[model samples]
Target chain A: MSDVYAARRGLLRDRCAAAGNAAALITRPANVRYLTGASPLGAVLLVGPSEDALFCAGAPTGEADEGRLDEHLRVTVLAGRGGDPAVAAADAASSVRADSLAVEEHHLTVARHRALRSVAPKVRLADLGTAVEQQRLVKDEGEIACLRIAAEIADQALGELLESILVGRTERHLALELERRLVDHGADGPAFPTSVGTGPHSGRSRHRPSDRRVEEGDFLSVCLGANYRGYRCEIGRTFVIGTTPADWQIELYDCVFTAQRAGREALLPGAAYREVDHAARSVLDSAGHAEALAPWTGHGVGLEIDEDPQLAPTAMGKLDACVPVTVEPGVHLPGRGGVRIDDTLVVRPEADGGPELLTITTKELLAL
Target chain B: MSDVYAARRGLLRDRCAAAGNAAALITRPANVRYLTGASPLGAVLLVGPSEDALFCAGAPTGEADEGRLDEHLRVTVLAGRGGDPAVAAADAASSVRADSLAVEEHHLTVARHRALRSVAPKVRLADLGTAVEQQRLVKDEGEIACLRIAAEIADQALGELLESILVGRTERHLALELERRLVDHGADGPAFPTSVGTGPHSGRSRHRPSDRRVEEGDFLSVCLGANYRGYRCEIGRTFVIGTTPADWQIELYDCVFTAQRAGREALLPGAAYREVDHAARSVLDSAGHAEALAPWTGHGVGLEIDEDPQLAPTAMGKLDACVPVTVEPGVHLPGRGGVRIDDTLVVRPEADGGPELLTITTKELLAL
Candidate 1:
């Protein structure tokens, strides 16, 4: 586990050197968390020629990361009241005689960039630019172990939810209940806000839970995940809320289930990202519901719920083994609701049992 | 309200023109919501020499706005499936033969900036900087009206929580209940994650809720806010768990209440931001609790929960009339726990009352 984070920093350091940078400043929270295994509020990672340091606004007071930090990492707690830590880091880098400090221009605000310039006038600020993100696209076995536990936690939470009498509960209450269940199952927190869309609200992407109650014969779409030890995974399932599903509801559910299966089956190494999205999107597209689709059929997930190697139409990447991504696609009728089936799966070569399905929640339309 | 949004845009346009730019692009969410009446996720507003246009990722999908587009504004809904709307806006400005465009470099990511450059190579890019944030420092009357409602909703939520059984309820459940009550009282959402700390967790700044439950003879500190029409306001109170507070609990509560009141009273039309913070800090400092104090006692609230004119010792700004802020001062004694009292108020002249209190939640420590 310690080797995973240290190796990530080592790779980043090599990329920084290749770009003619003696050191790199990381301000993105996800990247910071990835390299140092410790992400305090407003923390930055300074990977230099001499040593690697984690500079935080203040020390984190949470138990989300029990074993993420190791002795190899130097944790520098910034004073509670001080100027920007990035500026302080720039001055430190300059004083250490590190030439050409590369920074994540995408993450740093222009004002913060200007402050860094003022603090270390002699240090050159170069663009690091998505180097660490590319490094994080694939997961190591230890990271995958964390993701496995995260998925198990999500499964337990969702399984408990399935056993409950869900009728007459509002989407908001159900979402809150699922979140509490996530924490009860020992997750640091819900990876993202739980999405519980019911009745006319089902199948919408990232639907904000509302007061609309679960009704008889209504479509209930529930999507949630858990974050365990800095690793996160997702699972979504659409259910029928009555003894017998309506014909339209059953048909829509089957279509989405089939589409999600197609996307899952197409997850081999070297498969074009768009090909996976296309395989699933065409299932819904051929059925004349193309206008109701989301922009991406699926996306990579890791430290951040949504990461790189997006499975969209113009996404410029190939699927690699060990990269975990969610193949979620759905179609929603404007007024009558719709169905969406999703699962988080790690891309694996056919020789290694195809893709490793992390989120094993059943896609079968359940009736309660 | 329409006129207020229009006038806000006009002010920004004037500033851009003064800086020798005829067109400006605002990509920051809060700034976009402040300038335009709507923020439809991933949207950007383009202020031009002729007419203002809001380029959105998608059309409004809710009854929140109900097609009441301002007559003075032209709204362009992008039909594309994937891409940054800022690039579309820069292309539009280029198509219209605009020579140069000012962008919110402070908000725009370097990748997004590069996309803007690639889309419109003929156009020159300039940093609009924090002009919108500057305009947002002193909110308009309409914004104040929304903040007043937000505060009222928060107060109602907290008041209702006091009437319920508190003992044995987990911090997560209590936080969720407060959020549900906020929505029930007409809040669009919680201003931020509702903080409900108990026992040892009580009075801690930025404490994320946990599985800890309320117990007898424990201190219960809860901080929450409501978001109504994008305007946010905060209120926090520390209460005792037993039928009667201990002598130490009473002393701590009185000290926090005094500090909060002093900070609120110092919010005059011409008071320095640091002075308001000192008025609060001095009370706590004299009580021998300076070591446990937070960096800032209070901060302005509007489209964003933490806005300009921060009430901190190092903050450099004077309070202006119409500036709404929250004076929140707390002390956390490691093993003993402590107290915090917070309230949102708007700075005003003496003739109209020095600071108009928005949150009417009682400051008295209640035992439940």
Candidate 2:
């Protein structure tokens, strides 16, 4: 594990060296965590020829942080409160005689960038672009294991809820309960807020839970995921209340399940991201639900729930092996209910058995 | 209600006019919420002499927003999926006859500020400096009413939690349960991530909850707040987990309670912010706990959990009537648990009762 972080630093150093830079500064929290294993609040990672340093806001001590996760790195804790770690990292970069440095401009706000330039006026600042994120787009076996555990945690939480009565429960309470269960199942927390939309509110993307109670014959749509060891995965499913699902409910559920499966099966090592999106999107498009679709059908997931390799109509890039992505497709009628079924899977080569499914929550139309 | 948002906009317009700026752009979320009565996802308000416009990312709807918010103000929903409302407002400002436009430099990121300049090349951009925040420093009666309700909800949640068994539960569960109770009691949500620290983790300000379970004779400290209709307030209290506290626990708890009370009592209309901090600091300093103190003793809370009129030792500015602020001073021993007491109170004239306590949770030491 110690060698992993150090090897990543070496890789980044080589990349920056190739670009005519002596150092690379990482400001994005997740990227910092990936490179240094530890991210105290507002921390930054500066890698130069002579040194690799982690500059944090304050000391990182808590059961949550797992200190020294960066076994090969030394952390310099800032003394003053309200201090920017990026500026501190820049000063460290100059102290080590770093003449030119690469910084993540997309993550650093303009103000922080200017502050860094003034802190080390002699050093030439360059954009590192999404180099770290691009590296993160492809995962190792260890990263995939973490995502598998995250998906399993989400499945366990959702499975438990299916055993209990949900009628008359407000969406907010249900969502909160799901979150507590995620922790109970040993999750860092929900990958995102547990979205529980019921009845007429069903099938909406990222619908914030409301106080509305679940009634009989309503579509109870739940989208939830868990973060296990910093890796995230998502799973969404729609269930029918009462003993039997209505004809419309079954039809909608089957449609979404098919679309989601199409997107999942479309995942390959060399397919265009847009082609995968179209594979799922065409299913709904033929059913005359094209206008109601979200901008994207699936997206890559890793340290962040939403990351690179976006499976959108306009997305540019090819799918790569080991990239975990969510394939969620749904449609909602204005006043009637709607349906959504989603899954997390990793793209793989055909010889390796196509995409590896991470979230194994049953997508069958279950009537509760 | 419709007139209120319009009237707030009018007040801001008058302030900008007095400063010789023909228009002002408000980008901070809370400031926009205070002036517009409706907060979209990353929306900005541009107040012109003749026209007031609210620009947002997505197409917005709601009769109440049009009627109860600002009817006379034109609301423009951007046409694209991705567009910065601030830049759009700046372009609108330049095309219009406004000679000068002031923007919230602190809130606008360095990149956005430069982008705004590039979009509206002819517009003279000036620093709005913390003008809207200064106006928000002295909140209106309606704002106070919402904050009062928020405090009540938070108090209710904390009170109920204290009545439950706490010896075996983990800090994370306790924090999550308190949040659930807050929403149950009518809070939009917890103002911030609820803090629950046990034993050695106790008494630290802004401590994140962990999986540590409460034990016998442990000092349990908790800090939480509620958001009601966008208004927010905070309350914190520390209690022992056994039948009787240890000698050190009692001493620390009493000192913190005394300091919190003194700070609360100092909340008079004409009092200086530092004086309030001193009232709390002097008690702890005399007890030899000065080095362990947090940077800020307390701060104002309204649309934001932490706002203007910060009660730090070196802070400038004086208190004004109707300004609600928290007086939270704490001390922690590295290996031993500590205590923290906090409260929200409105600074008022002596004639109307010098200070009005909003968070009415009892300061009594409860052994749970």
Candidate 3:
């Protein structure tokens, strides 16, 4: 693991040197966690002149489940309370006599960037842009393993929930239960807040769990993921509440399942991100549900729940063999419920049997 | 409530106009929620010369807990998926013929700021520089009312947990249960992740919950809060898991209790922010525990859990009436557990009873 972290930092170092920067400061939490194994609160990774150092606002919690810092990297605990680690990293960069520092301009606020400049006036500031994120786009086998476990945890939790009585329970309670189950099955936590939308709220993307109880004829769309070793994966499934599904519910579920499958099938090495999105989106578009679709059909997931290579019409990129992405597509009609099917899969070559599905829970419309 | 949002926006508009800007764009979620009553995903508020408008990436979830936007504010749901609302808001400002626009530089990233500049090249961009945050410091009566309820909810949740059996339960489970109770009591959600530390993990500020189970003679420290109507409040308490606490445990708990009380009592209308922090920090400093204390004794709480008017040794400015802040002083003895006591209170004139304690949880150490 330490060697992996060191190799990752070395890659980042080469990228920085190629960009004319002697040092790079990583302030984004996920990026920091990627370069180093742990991301302490407000921690930043300064890679350059000296050995890469992880500057933290305070000591890491040292909780066993919350992974520790990679032993290969040096760690600096900020002495003063509420002091900015990014500024401390900048001072460290100056101390190392680095001629220039590259930072994630997209992550740093103008105020923070100005403070960093004030601390190291002689060190020329440059934008690191999405270099770290781009590096994270293609997951190593180790990262993919973590995502695989995260998906299994989510699948297990959802499977357990289906066995229990969900009727009369509020959407909030059900969501909370699934989260607890995720932890029970060994997850750091839910990668993102679990969404459980029932009745009129089902199929809505990123719907905040409400107090609405599940009704007999209603559709229930649940989207949840687990974070295992800092890697995240997502899965969504819509089910009918009664012993038999309503005609509209079945039709909507089948439509979404087909769209989601199309998206997944399109996830091949070198496929354009927008092409994958279009494959899924075209299904819904032909079904006359274009107006109610979410912006992106799906997106890459890794250290962060939502990462690079967004599968949207405007997204620009080509899929890599090892890139893990979620293919989720859904439609929501105002005042009436809809359906959504989502899965996390790693793009692979056709020779390797297309995309490898990490989340393997049955997508067939089920009546609960 | 709509009038209150309108009035808040009007005040911000006045501030921007005073700074020689014809329009102001609010991109910070809390600030947007403060001025528009609802902060939809990727939403930005544009206080334009033509009319104030709220631009959102997608339709607001309309969740029961997520309050609706102010009726007086026009809401523009972006037709394109994943469109940057800040950029769209800038375009709207330019369309209104505003010669200058002020934005929250402290919140907007350099990349997003550049995007705004690109979209509205003719419009002069000026830093709003914490203007909304300053206005939010001394909250309105209604805001305080919401905070009061939030505190009550947290108190209720903590009080119930005390009655339940604690021995042998993991910190993670206890934390999860408390969060469930918070939502069950009608909170929007937990204000932040609940912190539950046991034995050696106890007393450290912001200790992430672990798998450590409750044991005899172990110090158990729990910190949690509730989010009600967009207002957040925090309360923390440490208790002995067995019938008797060690002599050292009692001493540490008592010292922290006294320090927290001193900090709370020092929250007078005209008191300096550092003075309040000193009242708490000095107690621990004199107790030979100075080296192990957290940086800030307390911080203001509002739409966000952590906000302005930080009570720290180096924090500047004085307290004002109706300013809600948390005075949390804690110490963690490395190898052994420590103690932390926290509460949310509102500063008031001495004539009106100095500081009003929102969290009514008892400070006395109890054996469970």
Predicted model with the maximum lDDT? 3
Candidate 1 residue A351 Cα shift, in angstroms, is: 3.4
In model 3 chain B, which range of ten residues has the least summed lDDT?
B62-71
Runs off by more than 4 Å, candidate 2: A63-65, A79-82, A94-97, B15-27, B44-49, B52-70, B73-103, B110-126
Encode model 3's per-residue lDDT on B209-231: one tens digit a residue. Answer: 88889999999999999999889
Query: How do the residues A1-368 of candidate 1 rate in per-residue lDDT, one tens digit apiece?
Result: 67877888888888889889999999999898888777777888899875888776754555423456766777776644656778778988989988799999888877688888888888899999889999999898888988999999999999999899998988877887788788777887789989999988899777778778999989999999998877889999898888999998988888898899999999999999999999999999998888888889999999999998899888887999999999999888878898888899999999989999988877778897
Off by over 4 Å in 3: A63-67, B63-67, B79-81
Give per-model TM-scores: 0.92, 0.92, 0.98
Predictions ranked by DockQ, top down? 3, 1, 2
Cα lDDT listed for each candidate: 0.87, 0.86, 0.90
Fraction of native Cα-Cα interface contacts (under 8 Å, chains A and B) also present in model 2? 0.16
TM-score of 1: 0.92
Cα lDDT tens digits, model 1, B1-368, are 57877888999989999999979999998998888777777888899988988887764544224454577878777643676789889999999988899998778877678889999999999989889999999877878999999999999999999999999999878887898788778887789989989998899876788788899999999999999978999999999997999999998899999999889889898899999999999999999998888888999999999989789899887999999999999999887877888899999999996789999988878887
Ordered from best to worst lDDT, the candidate numbers read 3, 1, 2
Error of 3 at B202 (Å): 0.4
DockQ for all models: 0.42, 0.34, 0.67
